[model samples]
Target: MSNTETSPQGSQPDTPGPHSPEPPDAAPKARGLLRSSALVGLMTMLSRVMGLIRDVVVANYFGAGSSADAFFVAFKIPNFLRRLFAEGAFSQAFVPVLSEYRSLKDLAAVKHLVDRVAGSLGLVLIVVTLLGVLGAPVLAAIFAPGFYMNDPLRYGLAVDMLRFTFPYLLLISLTALAGSILNSYERFAVPAFTPVLLNLSLIGAAIWMQPLFQQPVMALAIGVLIAGSAQLLFQLPFLWRIQLLPAPTLGFRDEGVRRILKLMIPALFGVSVSQINLLLDTLLASFLQTGSVSWLYYSDRLAELPLGVFGIAIATVILPSLSRRHAEKSTEHFSRTLDWAMRMVLLIGLPAAMALLVLAEPLIATLFHYGEMADRDVTMAAMSLRAYACGLLAFMLIKVLAPGYFSRQDTKTPVKIGIVAMVVNMVLNLILIWPLAHAGLALATTLSAFLNAGLLLRGLLKEGVFTWQSGWFKWLLQVGVANLAMIGFLLLLAGSAEQWLRFDMWQRVSHMAVLVGGGATVYLLVLLITGMRLRHLRH
Candidate 1:
């Protein structure tokens, strides 16, 4: 359970090395943290790229119609479950406890804890998956009731597809368990890379298996099940190498397992507020005009690229590190790590948000204006994409800040904040949905994210868990100037959404590439000119 890996700049106590021995005086090192985060970010970047391709394939085939709407809703159910249980509450609760066991106990104890958790989690997931499958029709009504009333065929199809997708919840949750253990060991790459398997499976299904299915979208559901299994299987060897492979045993009463379950109960709500908000968006979108679901799906995917790559990558790396800091009673280092993460979020998230906002229409036009995707669909999706873009920074901030509480085994505070955010989202949804339609749902979600992030930050400060570092004002000024410069550069080169729609596929792709590349170049150049350096990026 100990990390023996040496750091590039000599070994740190918390530096994770496969099959390495622990050093008693090991401290959390900046270089080590950065390395872990970069590795996860790069792998996530690849997965997001593949995910984009998968979306493109789906758009080309199904477009934003009833069929696409049905599949998106079907897929969203299992995926929402996966994120909520596997990556959201479960990971947050499990990792901190697991990290404590590893840091404070022996290898045997750690392995014992793993076995009990795996067994308990596995048993519950199996039961949930069965229920989800059996209740697919009921779920279809609950998630997309508009379909049952106005479009029975789509409703029926969603129910059928969900039966295939529901099993993914069980498989991916177990996969998440494996990934969480690896993260505790500081082996971040394998888990980060696991998502690429899903993207590839969906892409292959869309390209190859879709033609074989009587209803095309069923192929994607099957692909999801296959990907779930592959991702779970892929983590086994890594776990074995680390010698923490579980020998399953029912551990409902196991002390460590009980602790995790206790933590997870509130975390279920605390850690997944964003996902819950998004699910609400999907539910509301269902009652909107047809194609609303698909438009939101596409727009959300674009916003998620940066969120997944930088935001999630940072959150994933920090949780285990923060857990280790907490276990070691290293309050100062913990504060520093949290501060570093927040700074990184601002540095990367600000520019990413600006770029998404500036290039929303061009990006949608370039990516999805294809066979089944009409010009109108492109316009609708871009509208929501911009709406989602508005919350990109807030979304990223929540990813890091929530972990600040979760790593400390403090779940109740976040739950309170989450409830407030959820209420605000619902109210804003009703207020905004009437005027902006599908885009309004996206806007409500964005606004709620700000509320969530702000509350989390306040909680951390009130508890004295984090102290503001000096020079924040100057740092913000630097980021603000760089973003303004990038926005100006993009605006000068930008064309109207209609003009973007007029271009052919190759032309659209080429023009978008130039805009993206040029924007990134300008942002980086402005940062450098403002006296920000590579070293300043490190904590």
Candidate 2:
């Protein structure tokens, strides 16, 4: 239903007046957005794969018990903040503004903007981190209130770990600042690959550092801090190569920093509704069974694999391109870019979601059912995984659609939509949790994601900023058929959860590999047969 005929590589408007300078000659070419996205996806895939290994290591050592629950709560607090503040809100606000400055101003002005923003952000995060570490008990109570009532020892452990992990908030936010600057410059790979350090660090900590600590969970907290520093340090050389290495200077009064802060205040809620819902789920889940938090954590990680590799990758690449398009006032190109991204989301997202739903048990069994992980834990995690999988497409769609608003400096609209979705999620949580327990928490999150994505799409349509591409119906039909074919193939191959549990780790891994490879092959073949082709992927 969209006007796909208009190229994403849109023609420039007339020469702009002094107030609105022309886009830089070095701005990323629109046609290359897909290639850039592919690069980011591949890099993210590596990171996500390493992250899975990290989780497997943790699960093997800790399993789904009180210590694991405490550690997850401790980690989730900062990890949630990392996404909400660092990657979600900060990057969303900073990148568009940074892109505009780079396109319109001189390199010196761009460098100054980076320095001032970094200084301001660093100062704020320092205060927040200090408060978090000093007030660890109160912070833990606020995030995992059930800890107070259910198990006092778990609450105590979480408080102790929070002090160790809270510093990661400051470190990773700085890393995100660096990543944002690199992304705006169209140097996407460095930021995309930075996550690998975090995963590798955690893996090492779980494997080697655990024996050194009286409490093994403390090892992961140490890993987080080291990874945060390493990830931040890793991006500096790339920034220096591009001559945007920020010289940190106190610039709270600077115009650009002020603009970013102003945008960030609202954009925080606007960009992070999904995270908020998940955090809420964590809070509520903490009051459930002892291992409820750990179950949700593992399942959420599996769902996030596709979302990271595909959804976030597309969003990351497009935000800069969309910002450039908006800077140039190329409305046609903006719409077409959104159109292209939406198609990519469906083309990949549907199959990925289907695969996750069908193979949830196999994945959980292969990845986490070893050492300390029990069969009951595997079964519980799979339920949550399938629930999260149901909302995968919506989650991925939100990733792409949000940038459409953010790039235009329109933060207010998404804030309103986000608020509505949050309220709806809370109401749904109460309604669903009684019946479904931890799995219900996940289902509520997924259902809320649908609400959020729907509102975002509706807003875009109502404002006439996005139109459905003309071939959407036919495209949907093709994707649906392909998904059904893929699902059927998977269901035929995938055995019961008990069957998966009966296998040794090597057997489970081998079976999963075949099912995954064959499912992808069948899905691709069906899509090709239904008239989808490689050229359709391009602008």
Candidate 3:
């Protein structure tokens, strides 16, 4: 047995530091996840803050009318492909392979693999962008057929805007490749901060270009191009620092390149399930009302704050590590590592979900109530945010668990589960759209996510993918208990805050302060009282 995987081929060992005390029971060390998640969170905060600035400009410049909605549709097309090819599908396949390469005894082959894959993916993304730019109208029709059917003006605008943003597919896809590279090296700060560059670029474009363009939508499209370019170019320095500055051989003969292609083919389909689910959600939302798409978009933006910052950071960091351990046949180490990652995600993700659901209104009201966003928009957005929160835990779990499959090169399993969830989401959308309106989209997404997470977990268990210490359930129960205690205080505090209605800005601020302060106090107290003590932080 290799030292890392003596327990089970897929198991992870507990990470222990020389100075750390032993846990009362065997535990997975999650310090790396914590450090990485927190760093990603801090950086994401900056990005989201900038993103909000960009949105504020958008909302003020183009409210939830046909125009804003049209522009968003154009924007999302390239974005959908970006997630599918670059960040979502490509990275899942790339990370593990790169990790395996890094772990290999042969360094020369590793360098060849990296250069060849970089050259190949770069070429592919460029070609995809060209095709998308050329076929923008056709692509727009697929996503928003209802619009093209109803209004030629809107349809034409969607095509124009799509042309401007199609390059985003190339930039962000390559950025994802760069990020996967940096993440594999454990030098995560650059990739974590890269999106902030995009957000900032948009914010600048929003401010400066508002007066430049004859139409605000044109300005927004230009901003998207600038932002996409910024995100891509920003990662180059870091790539050089890591000596991953590619010479671009584009060699098809490399065994590692061939292996990645073989794996990515299946994983790409798996990734399409998640992205297609969103596109499906958008299509169904379009049939409801003009504003429906934006509402879901805004809520999803909020939910992803936690998911992107923590869930993604951990998933990215651990996949490579897990891949290496499994390759070494370190069964115990693999299971232990998986246990630690799952536990940490559960412990942190559960609380964030609860807090979001509880504080949905205040958060929306605070962050988005300015500019052209009215109180009514806040209410609808908040409602959708709460609904999205219902599945925040599932989203994070999928982020963590999907990596487990990817690490072991089981891309087809996630693809299978993802397709099942997409089917569930599509069916629910068709059935519920008339009844619940946009809210149905949110609810359907949440339900489908749960279905996806459940399937992944079932697959893992059946395969004995990762064994946990016997007290896994007990740990979950403890987290649940602490969150329940936190919820009680939130209910009471929210009720009290509701009393201060007709108030000045300071009064509103004070009310928010009290609600935030009191709820946070209760949450921390409950955790401390229960001896949580960041128990999962060791790894």
Candidate 4:
């Protein structure tokens, strides 16, 4: 609780030389951001690939049936909260404050903050996990009421799975805490790579442990629990290597803990409005049809790949730098960093969204149209996938834009904007669900995200914190031409959804690989032809 400064125990200085005060020029900062983003993107890409494989395995075994629906809901409940609390709000809040301590205070003070926060956060997660396990049935009933009222078998299965999966919140939340610390020090790889462990654990469970359970789907719930433990354990050694392993101590009265809670409380809603919208989709999807939940799940997973890889990677790399810039009061640098992130978002996000929009059916069919998954399921999932794809740009924008506020520790404005967006999403959901069913719900989320991103961007611009740099018009033109070329190439090459379905797994994989690789090549080549050099991206 003391404000006094103290140095760390090692021979090393409190502030490392590599993370010294920012350079005067924007070029070096831009290069560092690009390098860090690439590293995080690579690690995140690996995790996303593993995640797609895990989903494929689940689809092969469970398909879009009552059990798959049940498992998705049960796993979604904790995973949803994990995003809302741990990764979303907690990370957004913790990183900026940690950066401030790292910048202004000594290493010992940083360690104190880490220890107290760990204890406070860990204790809360333990209690929440207990409540979640005990209240699994009630949670199942609340999250998927249609299952409770109309399908008791599915309802019971959800409850049983929830008990096993709910504890994941505790474990994964702790992992996120450790990750936040490592990321603050610019150790982006360890935290970004940690998710691959979860994907691997779930794949192993589905392949090997499914036969061990009578229900079979129960293995996935066990997998969630195992992955959480492994993810948390995997990061501890890295934390020790950094010499900042948390020694947990209750610090409810600590000043640093109080500040984090203050920022975190509002951020729970502000930073995670998109997630809240998705959860709303699940809540409503529960009542739509037998396969509605699974349809949304499959489609959303495909949409998440680009978002997680590029959108999140860019955001993750920038937040610490943004926080440091803010701490240093480098106003121009902060604005330029945000500008660079937006350009990257457009450069990557636009083409990715367009490709998904054009190839939704082929992508879904190729990845998930095997084994227990049926033709109807593939078609329906593609419909929702396209809808989610429509909003991918907004989703990516929000990832970059929200940090504009959080890096400055300004949480209230985003929360207000989030509330308005959430309300609009609920209204859109009601109006669309009756006509479009599950895809309507996906569309509603898409619309709300655009609103969220728009509002966040407007707030930053109005405050004069983010001024557009020169060449935006030319940059946008290049991106637009590149995306048009990519989309045209993809549409021409991607055959009908039925054709994709008829192909064997190897054929689907090979053809899809060609389409992806070929489309990317065209996009990049067009950009190069349009005179977009690497230096343009360096701000």
Candidate 5:
């Protein structure tokens, strides 16, 4: 996860070590990838549990009110910047450089590389943070325009909260750097699980902060600032264990650091386009009505559960392998490796995406439609959820495909593609917003995602980096068949779930269990009938 891995200074092709090649019967690279993915998935499951708890508390406390709306928009600003810079673009560039350093067995070189990048990044973050702090009101205005026009007090409060919490971008970005270094070393669980601390800190704050402040929203905002600090500190021990814990310095002369900056500039757009696109929707939604932000947030939270579990796990596991393979110039390995990962992504991502579309209402009702959230909010959120699900494959593909470009040290390509797709998204959003309202914005995001995925695939083909095989078509057919089976199973028998789907906590669990269990069985049964062997991706 360290910037050293992807830093421009170390952006060279991977060379084979003396022991690079193994026998053909040797362990398939996909197996190691899947194994690490499973470990990360397991840890992420725990983190998401805490996340759900945190969200439930949030919904209970705020209930899609104006206060909740303001808080989400405020929180999203720094969070988006954190992802845009640290975890998203900066790390993508940094990973390859750091990995190259490891491949070359250059420890001191890696340390110096780490110091330079970390120092330079820290300096950049401070300036960015200050600028953002000064401009929180304007930034909020841009991201959620309705806030300024409709509710002056909420907007002002959001600005003050942003000022308090904006430092989180610096801390979390640095934390992400630490996590990236650990991930490069195959220590996936610790880094993956660190998010749990965030949820816990927020939960603790929510419970205790209320007693301290008469205004619950202000308390929530202060809690957010505390939680951000907690998340940064939580990753410290993990960094120390890996011996890459960065010390404070101002040494920005290192060339490795320069390369990371080079890659990061492009990745800022390439990686953050989806969020940026979503932010655009939030800005538009601000004008629609109250609770628009909450509606989008709730819908996205449902989709994010599966995306985090499967899409993120698969992407995180395969990146190092992809980087290593590309560095080695093993074309066969690279092509086969990518194909295997795509299969894995589709394996989990498709079903997760589909389930949400079919079970949107039930899932939303079971999880949300309680407290002050209301039936109408649930309906609107469900509509948004289905729209979001429609593009899940595309969203997941971006995660998989962008890595192909990043690993090849070609961040510029995705940036170009992202720009085009973003333009389409903006146009579609404008066209659809009037007719479909908030749901249209979501649909626009989904459509633009598939467009981005298509472009990335085309680039991959043009460069001859990867290609489809005979099995690819067969797999697609099987996947379609499985999807049809899932649709009919749920569509025909959804009445059965009505009895099981109650807002009571245990009842909600039982509902998700029955639907997920029944739906999964049908998918597997169809796939088995169509000869979709596990051997394809599991190997």
Candidate 6:
């Protein structure tokens, strides 16, 4: 592995090769983290809005039915692997090393690492994609065993769709690799915006191509396949502009590639515990009822909106910054960066979670209760949505906290914590599933997330890697008061689920807009009144 300690101050000599237009600043400025995070957040918000629209369309067409269940499972298998390998482990592993290279080596050396990693990753993905295509039945059966045993038709649909969607793993993982590179250079917008293509492609497929398919859900599968390619292609130009576009070369024996692999292997388990737990929920939910998987999917999508937009946006910006700080041996800056991230997570995550919990039914009913999505589907999905919402803060915490370890290239501690959390989740699933059914699975995941977040925070504290910044008590109290105020406002404004159900789509949209906008306004006002200021969030 490249030595980061060589440059304790993180000063780089001017070396010839392509480099980012931005200057290399070892110490993070007050606006840098917040500005970059906002840019990424804005782009991610666009993608997530499109994703919600796509889900709304899918719900109108498929609803929480057997076909929807099949499609979700098929899509989820690759999506799970994408998060596990690409976004979760690969990003966690690659960014820190990339940061080291950029800080210590010339741009030429950085490009070489990118090329070798690309070639190696691409080769593995091709083999995996081919195997997944050929073994769709096996994958489907393993992921959704209930379908295999009880619903052969659904199982068959899932198997067929898996053949189409599984290749998405290969394409999207490459996209993620490109994204990680872009992120390392602080080019956050393109990668953050790339997901909009997926949502757009899926929306186009559902609207235009569904009629051509004998099984309409299969159109969605084709959409997934197309979106993966589109997303990968979309980032290439930006990569070229940055002059870090990879020219693939086999480099399994290369030192940097080997190091990334070593880190990524352990991180596969450590960084993706939440995804693994969700997949487990899917696995078990497959057996519960026809629509259990779909209910969970809908609810999870809504839960992911704030997470993707804010939690991930913040994490994405911080990893490269944190890694640079670590490379510079700037322990105080690293801890401060983390503290800033945690505060941001709490500032946004608290009210978001409360709003989701308070307005779960209304959100589900407004966005998804249309056409084929029945009232019962909305009710069931809302239940799981609320359950997932309860864990929103924990989920966001994990996003921010895990990066603290990953930026330092320490994956083992999170792996151990993740294992304990996963086991506890399984136990909770078994104990709760009998009584609460699908929502039980959601609840179990939520509870396990709290455990995961708590352990991660504890580890960081114990290591003295993340010291508590002063005024935390005041920060928490202010956030708590603001959140309580938001909750009360939302509960007062958000009518019953049945009222939302009876309203037409326009009414639902208007009412939801008011509740969301109002609740945010109230929360911000309360926080400001409690003496919080924008400057407090600066690192």
Query: 143 in model 5: Cα distance from truth in Å?
Result: 2.0
Please identify model 3 stretches exceeding 4 Å from their true place. 1-31, 495-510
After superposition, the stretches of candidate 4 with alpha carbons farther than 4 Å from their true spots are 1-31
Give all TM-scores, in the order shown.
0.96, 0.95, 0.90, 0.96, 0.92, 0.96
- In model 3, the worst 10-residue window by lDDT is 1-10
Clashes of 4: 0
For residues 1-539, could you state the per-residue lDDT of candidate 3 as single tens digits? 01111222211223222322433123223335566666666766677767766676677667666777788899889888888778877888887887776655344555577789889988887888899999988998889887878768777888999999889888788788878887766556677778877777666776787678776677778888888778778877666655566667787777877878878888876655656777887876766666777877777777888787777767766787787677777878777777777887887788788888987767666555556666677678777888889998888888888878888888888888887898889998878777788887788888898898888888888899776666776677777888898788777676432333334456666777887677667777876776667644556
lDDT digits (tens) for residues 419-465 of candidate 1: 99999999999999999999999999999999999999998999998
Write the number of the candidate with greater TM-score, choosing between 3 and 4: 4
lDDT of 5 by residue, 351-387 (tens): 8888898888888777766677777887888889999
Task: Write the residue-wise lDDT of candidate 2 on 1-539 in tens digits.
Answer: 11121224322211232323444432344437778889889889999999999999999999999999998999999989999999988899998898788667667788899998888888899999999999999999999999977789999999998999999999999999988987776677788889999999999999899999988878998898999999999988777766778888989899888888888889989899999999999999998987899999999999999999999999998998888889998888899999999999999998999998989989999999999899999999999999999999999999999999999888999999999999999999999999999999999999989999999999999998788778889899999999999999999989998899999978998999999999999999999999999888886
Where does candidate 4 clash, by residue pair?
Answer: none
lDDT for each residue of candidate 6 in 1-539, tens digit (9 for 90 to 100): 12211133222322112453334563344247898898889999999999999999999999899999999999999999999999999999999999898877777888899999999999999999999999999999999999999999999999999999999999999999999987776667888889999999999999999999999899999999999999999888767766778999999999999999999988988999999999999999999988999999999999999999999999999999898889889899899999999999998998889888889889999999999999999999999999999999999999999999999999999999999999999999999999999999999999999999999999999999999889999999999999899888888888888899999999999999999889889999999999999888776
lDDT of 6 at 348: 92
Model 1: how far residue 24 lies from native, Å:
5.0
lDDT of 5 at 506: 80
Model 4 deviation from native, Cα RMSD in Å:
4.1
Winning model by lDDT: 6
Compared with the true structure, the alpha-carbon lDDT of candidate 2 equals 0.88
lDDT of 2 at 256: 89
- Residue 470, candidate 5: how far off, in angstroms? 4.0
lDDT of 5: 0.80
